[model samples]
Target: MKKETFLAFVALFLLTLTSVVYALEETTKTVTIAEQKADITGDRELDTILLKGVPYQDETDYLKQIFLEVSASNGTAYTIPLESGAKASFQLVDMNDDGVKDLFSSVQTGGSGGIVLSYLHSLKDNVLVDLPVPDPVEIDSHFLNGYQAEIKIKQTGKTYRFLLKDRKSYYKKLGLYYKGKLNEPTELMVNSYHSLKPITLKDGKLGLKGVQRVAGIANADTIAYVESTWAYLNGKWKLDNVKVLEKDQ
Candidate 1:
């Protein structure tokens, strides 16, 4: 074969191989992780709800693409996409007071911060809609002198102070503190929703409770926790209250 012809053939072969590999990476295999029977369409008929996702390369517990498949009794099938994470699960609850079950899902991020992603969806009247989850509470935290830290909840204008005398040795070793004083201005790390779940309120209505973590220098470092209560009213979510608790020693 001529040298030019042989080089062209080699290039073609390499191109074909690259295309095949790219296709495999783009392809995803989905599997059902959980299934349940519930009436979410407000039709008083059973609906088959299947939680499906694509595992991250044979990691059965970690999903890359999570979705929901609902087969309504009225001969309608719906697909809803959700965030990806590990240990994906859902609960059927009447969260919006529509008298129909809503799909509330939670996924563990499996990160050092122990963060979680939550979602809510309603399929009432054969229409699928996403219900917005409550946003994390905004906070302003900073290291203070005298081995102390302060966190202020911006929403409620509440401030909390923590004494870190017990952790003085650890903070000193990490150069975060020197002689009971902060070496420099540093802010505490606040993580997103660690857990969000439906709860029954005082007025016999369903609402959501979200818990957030505030860490010191490191994610595992102890600091405080913020809890927020929310109520769904007038077609929107309303913040009921906020609570701050110091981390147990």
Candidate 2:
């Protein structure tokens, strides 16, 4: 072979190698807790990424800029623009039971206590599409009503309900006291927390069990209470079977 041809071949090979190295650097990234990153696709690969920008100089500026960079395993890159003042994070789950994972994002909305801003996003045709997320009232209470697959927020004296509807979350109804009364809350009314514990049901399908802890009603000294299995259906949180778990002075 000619020496000139050999030189040309070597140059092309070097250029191709350089492009591959640059692509790898762009695809590999690190996420910090402050960013609230998650793998929204459920692909077991962290393709979704979020980066927050500095706040505006004026406090009145309601929009806080955010950059969402998605890097596919096949060397595809996409940048999405999002605006919110709160620090953002995400949870990836199959919210609609559609097998494909859905994205749930939350941002801290500061107030007397702390409020959270929620948003939902889903992947379609390899792009992130914004979906409606459940929004509860301004969370001024300490006890978060967060249960699995639901966004529950208890306000000062009232708890607002929200649930997924048609692949989007919306305000459903208000929570009632165990006695079937409009749950009128007070600063000293009650403070409760719930959890969505994973369990294997008799039907052999994986499910989440809702367990609520009624810590107090009026004050720390008030101990009379009840424990129940809660389920949200028909736009209401119904007590499956109420049992007088504890009662006292």
Reference-based TM-score of each model: 0.88, 0.37
Residue 191 lDDT (model 1): 94
lDDT of 1 by residue, 1-249 (tens): 999999999999999999999999787678898999988998888999999989877677788888889999999999888878877889999888888989999888887888889989999998998988889999999999998899999989989999988998898999998888788999999999989999988888889999999999889996998999999987788999999988893
lDDT of 2 by residue, 1-249 (tens): 899999999999999999999997775443333443445555555664545444544653333555556665445666655546546555555444445666555555443223344455566445666754322222232222231121123322433322213212211233423223223432323333222332334444333343233322223323223233433334333333333233332
Error of 2 at 78 (Å): 3.7
- Candidate 2: 10-residue stretch with minimal lDDT: 163-172
Instruction: Give each model's whole-structure lDDT.
Output: 0.90, 0.43
Listing every candidate in turn, what is its Cα RMSD in Å to the true structure after a full C-alpha superposition?
Answer: 3.5, 17.1
